[model samples]
Target chain A: MSGNENREKYKLNVGKIYEGFVIDHIHAGRGMKLYKDLGLEKLDCSVAIITNASSKKMGKKDIIKVECPIDRFDLETIGFMDHTATVDVIKDGEIINKPKLSLPKTVKNIIKCKNPRCITSIEQGLDHIFVLTDPEKEVYRCKYCETKYGEQ
Target chain B: MRHLLTPLDLSVEELETLMDNAEKIKADPEKYAHVCDGKIIATLFYEPSTRTRLSFEAAMLRLGGKTMGFATADSSSAAKGESVADTIRIISCFADIAAMRHPKEGSATVAAKHSRIPVINAGDGGHQHPTQTLTDMMTIRALKGHFDGMTIGLCGDLKFGRTVHSLIRALLRYKDVRFILISPDELKLPDYMTDEIKRNGAEYEEITKLEDAMPRLDILYMTRVQRERFFNEEDYVRLKDYYILDMPKMELAKEDMIVLHPLPRVNEIAVEVDEDPRAKYFEQVQYGMYIRMALICMLLDISL
Candidate 1:
C-alpha cells in the first residue's frame, strides 16, 4: 500500500517517429505526472495502476508503471500541434503519438507578420518562411513577417 | 547584373562591384549615360508603386535607355490571368534587361528562372527589395566611402521593414559595423534578423527611445508606421504621432549623422529638419535612381 506513492522505474520513448523534433521528458519526482499526461492511448481509466514490485531502494512496497503508445507516427519535417490545442494523434483509425509542433522551412504561406502594414500578409502569393536563427534564445521570425519572435 | 533575385544568390564581391560602379556613375552620370543607348526598360509593375517603378524607368532613361511597361497590374497580362513567369519571359524578348516589381515574395525568383535577360527585383511581396539595398549601399558609400566601421540606427517598423531587412542582410557581408535598433515594443526588429545579428557576431542594441540612440549613430534609417497595423487603435493613436523626429531629436544626433527614409514618408520626420545638410534622404532618393540606372546598364550586359 505504501509503495503505491513512491516514484521510480520511469522511462520515456521518443520513437523515431517525430524525427526532426524531440518529444522530450524530464523525470525524477515529477516523472509520474509527466508520464500520466502522455498516457497510453485507448485506456479507459484515467488512473491505471501498473504492477509494482517491492523495492528497498524506492522505500516503497510497489512501483506503478505508466505506458504510452507512439502507435503509428512517421517523423515528418513540419510541426502540427501545441499545448491547449489538445488533439489525438491518429492514423488509419489507430491512435498514434502526440507532440507539440512548430513550423519548419516547408510552410508555403504567411499566417501572421510582425508588421501589420507590410504587404506580405495583406497580399497573396507570398509565403512566409522563418529560419531558426537562435535556438537557445527560442526565437522564430517570419522570413517576410519581419515580426520577430519575442522581439522585445 | 540582371534580375535581383534573393540577396543570397550574389556573392559579396558581386554586390561590392555594383556599389563601386554605382559610386563612379554617381560622380559622373554623363560618363555612363551612353552605355545603354536604345535599351528599353519595362517597369511591369504588377502593383502600384510610383517611387520604385518610376525610379527604375528614370534610371533607364537617364542612362539614355528607353522605358516602357505597365505601372499597374490591372493593366497588364496579370489581369488576363497570365502567370508571372510567362510575362517575364515575354518581356525579356523586348527589353535587354528588366527591372520588375511584383507583389509576390518570390515572384522575381520565378521570373529570374525563366527570363533570358537579367531581372532586377524592384520590390517583391514584402519579402525583399534588393534595389533598395543597392540604394542603401550607394548611400553608405556616398557618405562613409566604405560600409565598414559605421554605427547605423534603424528605427520604425524594423519588425517588418523590407528595406531594413535587405540592408541588414547586405551590411552583414562587411566588417566592423554596429547597429542601434530603435522602435516601440510592438514594432521591434524581427527575431529572424536578430538571430542573424547574434550568429554573425555583430554588435547591436535594441531600444525603445530614438533619442537615447540618436547621439551615438552615424547613420539613421527611418520607415513609416501605419496606424492600421495595430490590433488596437488606442495604442496606435498614442504612439504614432510622437514618434516623428523634430528639432529636439536632431540636436541629440551626431553632427555627422545622416538621416534616411525609404520614402513615401507620412510625417515620421519633422519638415524643419529637411533643410539641414544631413537630411540626405532626398539625395538618397535621387541616388536610388542613379544606382538603379547603374544596375540596369550592368544587368543588360552593356559596358562602360
Candidate 2:
C-alpha cells in the first residue's frame, strides 16, 4: 500500500466548525468523558470528536469541535475536568478567543464528596461543594468533610 | 461566626483564650457555673459515641445549660432520611448552640452552613475530632506548662486515629513541636497528614517500635488500636496489642513526662499504668470536660 493510502485509512474524520468552539489538547483517552460531561450528545448541535490525535506538545490528545458557542461557565467546568485543555472560540471558520484552562478556586456540585460520612452523603439537597486548597497540586477538598478530591 | 469543624477554625489567639478560660473555670467552678444559664445546647449525635456525647452533655450541665438531642442515628430523624441541613435548620429554633458527632466525615460542616447557631464537631468519622484535639492541647499546656519545644510521641493507630491527626495539625502552630510517629506499617500515618507536617517545616520520625521513641518523648500520646477500623479480623488481632504502656516503658520516659489518651481504651494502655504520676489520661478526661465547658462558653459568647 502507498504511504498516503495508509495515512488516509487511520486519519480521524474530524471536520471544522464555522461557528462555536474547538476544544483542543484534551488528555488522551479523556475526550469521550469530556464529551459526555459537557452534554454534547444531548445538545442539538453538530459535534465532532477525534480521539488519540497526534500532537507535538502532548504525545497523544483528543479534540472536540462543536457547532454552538460554549458558555463561560461551561468553559470553566471543562477546565476543571482537564486543566491542560484549550478552548478556542470560532466565528466564520476563524479562531477567536482561546482562553487558557485553569483550576477554578471553588466548584459547586461538580464533583460529589466521596467520604461516606461526609455531610453531602446523608444530607439531601446539599450542594456537593469543594474548594481548591492546593492549586499547585490541583487538589480540591470537600468543603464539608475536608476530604481531598480523588482520595475518596 | 464560631464553628469548630477543624482545628484550623480556631486561631492561635482564640485557642489561647480558650485555654485561659478553661484554667479560670477550673479554679472557681461555682463563680462561672451559671454563665450559660437558660441557654440550650443541642447534642445532635448521629453516631454512637458515649464518651464524647457525655462529655459534651456534662460540659453543658456544668455550665448550667440544658442538653437535648438524640444519642444515636436510630433515635434521631436521620434514620428517617432527614438531611443534616434540615436537622440543623430545625434545631436552630430550639438550641443556642449545637454539638454534633457523625459517622460521615463532614456532617458538622453541612450543619454549620445551614444552622444559625454555633456548631461544634464532636467527631466526624476519621476526618476530624477538634474538641478532643482541644482537650489534648489543654492537657499538654497544663502538664508541660507551654506549647513549645515538646517531643510528642504518638503511638498506635495513626492511620484511623482522628485525634492524632487533629492534635498534630493544631500543635504545628506552636514553636519547635516535633513528633515521634510510632505505629505498625499497616497503620502508619496517612501521607496527606505527613505532607502537612513537611509543609509546616516540622520535624517527625516514623518508626514501628514504641520503646525506641519513649526515652526521647516529653509527652507520650497513646491511642487504642481500634478493631472497628480494620476490615480484616486477623489484621486487627495482630496489630491490637502492638504497644502496651506498662511500668518498664514508663521508666524509659522522662520522670516528668506525661501520657495523654482519648479514653475508652481497649488494652493498648495497661491498667497498672494508671497509678503512675505520668498517667494523665484520666486527668485528660477532666480536661476534656473543662475545655469543652470553656468552648461552649466561648462559642455562645458568654462572659465566664
Candidate 3:
C-alpha cells in the first residue's frame, strides 16, 4: 500500500477511547516503555498505542490512549521521564483536560536504583525513587544511591 | 536536626560552632569527659573502616557515652536481607544517636528517614563524607587560622576520591580560594566539580604534574589512586603512583605548606615524608575524633 494509505490504516488502528487519557508527543520509539512505566499494560481498560506518528513539532511521535485517566502521581512521573510528553484526559469522547507537563523535583516508584550498594538494591519492598538534582540539565539521581539515572 | 546527611544541612554558623566546641573539648578533655553522661551512640558500619568507626567510638567514649553496633553487614541482620530503613529504626531504639558508615552513596539518607534519634553519616560511598569534610575544614582552620585566601592543591585520584569532592565544595564557601587540581587525565576531577567551580567564578587549574603545582600550594590534599576504580590493570598501575610526595617534592613546596591525606595510604605519600613537620595527617586523625565528639554533642542536643 502507499504511504498515505498506511498512515490512514495506522490512525484507524488507534481507535478513540470513550473515557481515558491520551499521552501524546512521546518521543517516537519510547511510547511502549512509558506505557509500561505507567503500568498501563497491566490495566483492565482498553489501551491503544500509535507509534511513529507524524508530528510538526517532534518530526515523529508516539501516542498512548488509555481507557482510564492516569492519576496525578503517574502523570507527574511520566513528565519526569519525558518532559515533552503531554497527557490529555478524555471523557465522553471529548478532551477535558491537558495536564501541565513539568519535571518533578522528586519521583517515587519509577526509575530503579542500579547502584549495587544502594539500599533499594539489597532491601525488599522498597520503592525506587530519584531526586532531580540539576533541574536545568534535567538530571535525576537516585534518592538513596545518588546514581545518575540515565548513565548506569 | 535529627540527622547529618550532607554538609549543606549544617549552616556556616553551626559549622563554626561545632569547630569551636571541638577545640574547647580538645583543650580541656577532663571537663567534657562526662558531658554525654548516660548517652549511647550506635556505629552502623556496613563497610570495613578502621579510622572512621574508631574515631566515632572513641569520641563517644571520651564524652562518657557508651558505644555499640556492628562493624560489618555480614555480622548484622543486613546480611540476612534487612533494609537500611528497618535497621536504622531498630537502632534508634537502642542508642541515643547513631553514626553510620555505608558503602552506598545515600544509604545514610535512607537510614535518616527512619531514624528517630540523630543519625550522623560517618562516610557514604563516593557521595558525601560530611564528617571527614568537617575534619579537614577543622584542620585547615586550626593551621591557617582562616578559610579565606588559601591555594589548595588536590593530587592523585580526584575522580573517585569522595573526600576531595567534599573538601572542594566546603572550601568554595570561603573567599578567594583557588584550587590546583593535580591528577592524570584519566583520573581528573569530574565535570560536576569543575562546573560548580566555574559557576561560582572560582579559579582552578588542571595540572598533571604535582611538583609543578606544589610551590604555590598552601595546602596539598593527597588522595589514594585506587586500582579497583580503573577499567584496566595497565591504566591502574600507570596512574596509581602518579603523585607521590617525596622529599624533593616537599622541599619545592612552601615551608609552612600543610600536607593532608585521608589515610590508609599505599605509598601515595612516601614514608620518609611523614617525618616532615608539615605532614599533619596524624593531627588530622586526632581532629577527626574531636570533631566527631563535638558533632555527637551537637546532634544529641547535649551542652558542653
TM-score per prediction, in order, is 0.69, 0.94, 0.93
Stretches off by above 4 angstroms in model 2 are A1-13
CA lDDT scores, all candidates in order: 0.68, 0.89, 0.87
What 10-residue stretch in candidate 2 chain A is worst by lDDT? Answer: A68-77
Put down candidate 2 lDDT per residue, A1-152, tens digits, no spaces: 99979987977767767889988899999999888877788898888888999888999999988898545228657888898898889888998788888898888877788876566776668788889888888888888767789996
- Candidate of highest TM-score: 2
Residue A116 miss distance in model 3 (angstroms): 2.9
Interface DockQ of candidate 1: 0.09
| Clash pairs for candidate 2 | A117-B104, A117-B105, A118-B105
Candidate 1 Cα misplacement greater than 4 A, ranges: A1-152, B227-239
Weakest 10 consecutive residues of candidate 3 chain A by summed lDDT: A68-77
lDDT of each residue in B49-126, candidate 2, tens digit only: 888899999999999999999999999988888888889999999999999988877777778888899999998888
Better of 1 and 2 by lDDT: 2
Which is the leading candidate under DockQ?
Answer: 2
Docking class of 2: medium
